[model samples]
Target: MKFVIYKDKLVESVQNVSKAVSSRTTIPILVGIKVVATDEGVIFTGSDSDISIESSVEKHENDQINVEVIQTGKIVLHARFFSEIVKKLPDKQVEIEVTDNFHTIVRSGKAEFNLIGLDAEEFPRLPEIEEGLSFQISNDLLKTIIRQTVFAVSTAESRPILTGVNWVIEKDLLTCIATDSHRLALRKAPISINPNKSFNVVIPGKSLTELNKLLDDNQEPVEVVFMENQIVFKTKNLLLFSRLLEGNYPDTSRLIPDESKTELTLQTKEFLQAIDRASLLAREGKHNIVKLSTLTNNTVEISSTSPEIGKAVEELQLERVEGEDLKISFSAKYMLDALKSLEEQELTISFTGAMRPFILHSINDQSQIQLILPIRTY
Candidate 1:
């Protein structure tokens, strides 16, 4: 393989694809990146089975030439060392050549490095996805959906299915829900597409998090194509494929209470800060629990007590309070995460009692809701 490419373009491609490279893999070749030089451009691929990222440095984009392929060939170079070398190369352009015997030479400016390259045939083939189901969404919107719910996925391996976010599409509305048993985050947006198609899928939280990093806050559209087992995300010159999680994601619809005994409307930022302060004392407690009690008609008291450490108490005057006065204790972390996901300035929290899970939502937006299971802080 031989190619001469601008150093900046090459560096960017390598850094982007490196998100998929895994060092602790059973397949030794998975630790390296597949660099394919063709007549059109240079393609870099990094994968570790679950996810793969393919980024290309095209010959010309927006009237700019980024790569010139001298010889059509393919080679796999160590991802870690090669990426670092490309970044530090003191030249405007990089020249790479691979011999038939797998010996590779990378040269830029006055620095030259020769590393053994692996046969590209050894790299695992990316899954071939046929046209099954597809839709287009704005990149900015997809990133927002990911950020709003990915944080709530369970980190424990006990319930493997809970480690992913449940995505359900019924007509034009797409809903994403994630929970770790303690806290749940949910987001919904109307997709601009045909309203006849319906689909349900579970995607790993880690995969969505990785895709979020690759997406810029740009105004371009992303094409999402999903089959029975794999999903593809395409935008510009980037293509990302991730395997779908199997098994029935527990029906969480019933878990969210339909009625509430107490409802409190408060400023989102103020409530978050109150929980933040309460958490400081609760951090030393067993469950990091914070208690919220309605002290007066519209005044809510937020307090936390640690047997060994001091206690914290703060009063938050709510914009409105209805239903019944209540007191409940839940993980401060859970409440904080749920509060941060809201885009509105004001929020309404519904409590079904001190034991049942509480629900949170924007004051005006009922499409997105968060649930937090209260902790027994006796």
Candidate 2:
């Protein structure tokens, strides 16, 4: 393909599409990016078997030429090398031309390089997903939901389903849940537009993590299209496709207790800081466990002890403490992760018992819930 394009726009598009490129792919063509120049614009595509990304650079936007097409053609160049070349190009414009036998030349400023390109026909076609179930959500809100839950997905492959975040949409509300058996995160938000049918799907945490990075923190709406096995996320100039994980996500509703034996309300920041300090000592222990115990006069004691290191004890004043007296031990790392996901002035933590899982929720927001199982310290 022969085209002249703005350097910054091309760089951004290349960087985005490169996220789907797999370094260990058995298919040699998958290591390269496919570029197609047409009358409309230039399209760049990158894909492994699991995920694919396509980004377009229009010929002209707002009466300014973004791309000047010299000829309509297609070629594939090594993704890694091409991306590096584009980034280091000395000029604001880049000219790319493919000649006979797929020999490509890239030129910018005083630098020019000849690269052996592959036939674009060898690249796998992107999944053709017919628009079936679709919805729109604000980009910023989607990023928030991912950040709150994706961290809790299991990194191990023992239970493959736990490696993905579960998404369920009913009526006008969307709920996202992630858990690694030790800790769980759940967040719910109201959907601005609802589809005709409910959707229950498991999306790999890795995919969501990558997609989250591509999304900008803006109020613009992102369109989502759902098919049988693939999900598509689309913006103005970008299209992202990810294969859904196959398997029924375990039902986690029953894991949360109906009632609590002990309930405590405290400033979220104070509690987080106390746990942060206590974890310094707990790090020397076997499991990094921290103990929390209710004290008299609406206060709680956070403490950790390590025989090899030292002990840390801090008293945090609570806004309210009720129900039964309690002492619970849990992983300080897990507690810190759960607490950091929340942005609230105050939070309420409820303990079912010393052994059962406890839940943390914002005092003002009931849409999110974090649960952590206690660790036994003997």
Candidate 3:
């Protein structure tokens, strides 16, 4: 393949596609990026069996040429070396050409490098997903949903299905939920476009994390196409495909209590800070646990005790406290994570009891909920 491309566009495309390149793959070709030059534009593809990313640089956009293809061909080059070389090119333009026997030459400014390229045919083909169901969501909203729930996915491999986030769509509503057994996060959003059928799928948490980084915080709509086993996220010039995790995600609906015995409303920032300070002493202990107890005069006492270290206690005024008195202990890390994901100034925390999980919801937005299982401390 021979093409002369603008350095800025080339670098961006390479960097985005490189996210899918596998460094420890048994297949040597999976470590290389396949570059194809056609009449339409130049496409860069990277895959590691689980996820694949393809980024395209059009020949001309808005009457400005981004990539000028001299010949229509294809080649695969080492992803790591090629990305580094393109990023450090001295000039604004780079010329790449592949000759007989897959010999490649990359030139820009006064620097030149000869790389041994592999036949593009060796690269594994991306799964051909039939577009059975599709929908669109604002890029900004999708990123928000991912950030709120992906953190709660289980890191342990004991329950492989719990390592992914569950996505369920019914009618025009989409709900995302993730849990690690100790805590859970849930987010609900309205879909702009309704699919022909409903879907319940588990997507790997790591895939969503990488895809979230690629999305820009904009109002532009991103097209999502879902197949039986694969899902494709398409934006302006980029496409990301991820394989769905196999297995049935456990039913978590029953895990959330329908009613609470106690409810407390407080400033989100104040509560978060109190937990942050209380966790300092808790971190030194065997379990990073913090205790919260309702006090008189509508205040909550946050404290932590460690045998080797001293104790920390702070009283914070609550906006409202009602129902039965409550005292609970939970992982400070889990509480902080759930609190940080909220964008509200005020929050309502509901407790079923000292032994059951507690729920948190934003005062203004009821679409998202966070639940944390209390840690038992005698």
Candidate 4:
């Protein structure tokens, strides 16, 4: 493969595709990046079985030349070494050439490196997805959905299915639900495409997190293709192929309580601060449990007691309180994560009781909700 490319553009493409390169892959060739230079552009692909990322550096765009392909060919280069060398290149242009025997040379300025390249034909070919189940979503909205829900997925391997976020689509609504059994996050948004199509899938949390980092927040719409066992996220100059998690995601509808015994509207920032202070003491208790009790005059007390450590108590005045007075205990970490993920300034908290899970939602927006199961610290 022979290509002379702008160093800056080459570095960007290399770094983007390197996200999927894994050092522990069973396939030897999977440890390296497959580079293919064609007349139109230079494509870099990296994969580690579960996920694959492909990034492209076009020859030119908008009257600006990015790369010149001298001899169209393909080769696999060590991802770690290639990425590092590209980043530290001393010149504005990079020249790469791969001989017929798979010998490679990279040059820029006065520095030149010789590498033994692998035959690209040996690299695993990505599945040819002919399925027609595809949809288009705004890049920003998709990123928001992943950010708001992926955090709540279980990290434990005990329940493998819980390690992924459950995505359900009905008509034009797309709902994402994630939980570790201790805390749950739910978000909903409108899907303008494939309104008549309906399907449920469990997307690995780690995949979503990586894809979110690679995706850019642009006004353009990205195409999402769903296959029998794979999901593809395609954006301009980038593509992410992720395997779908097998097994059924538990139905979470029954977990949320229909009625609440207590409801309170409070300033999100103030309540979060109070909880933060209480968590300092709560952490000493191992459980990181913080207690919230209703007080007089539309006020609530946030407190934590560590037995070995002293207690922390803070009062937060609420905008409104209704239903009944209540006291609840929950994990400080979970509480903080749920609050930070929300975009609302004012939140309405509903408590069923000290034992049942409590729910938080924006006063104006009901589409997104966070649920934290209370701790038994009576």
Candidate 4 lDDT, 44-123, residue by residue in tens: 99999899999998888999999999999999999999999999999999999998689999999999999998989999
lDDT of 4 at 160: 92
In terms of lDDT, the poorest run of 10 residues in model 3 is 190-199
* Model 2: lDDT of residue 59: 96
Any runs in candidate 4 off by more than 4 Å, and if so which? none
Q: Candidate 1 has which clashing residue pairs, if any? A: none
Which window of 10 residues has the lowest lDDT sum in candidate 2? Answer: 190-199
Tens digits of per-residue lDDT, candidate 3, 132-172, equal 58889999999999999999999999899999999999878
How high is the CA lDDT of each candidate model? 0.90, 0.93, 0.94, 0.91
| Top-scoring candidate (lDDT) | 3
Which runs in model 1 stand beyond 4 Å of their true positions?
192-195
Error of 1 at 52 (Å): 0.7
TM-scores for every candidate against the unseen true structure: 0.97, 0.97, 0.98, 0.98
Model 3 pairs in collision = none
Q: Could you tell me the lDDT of residue 108 within candidate 1?
A: 96
Q: How accurate is candidate 4 locally (lDDT)?
A: 0.91
**Comparing 1 and 2 on lDDT, the stronger one:** 2
Stretches > 4 Å off in candidate 3: 192-195
For candidate 1, lDDT tens digit of each residue in 15-92?
Answer: 989999999999999999999999999999999899999998889989988888999999999999999999999999
RMSD of 3: 1.2
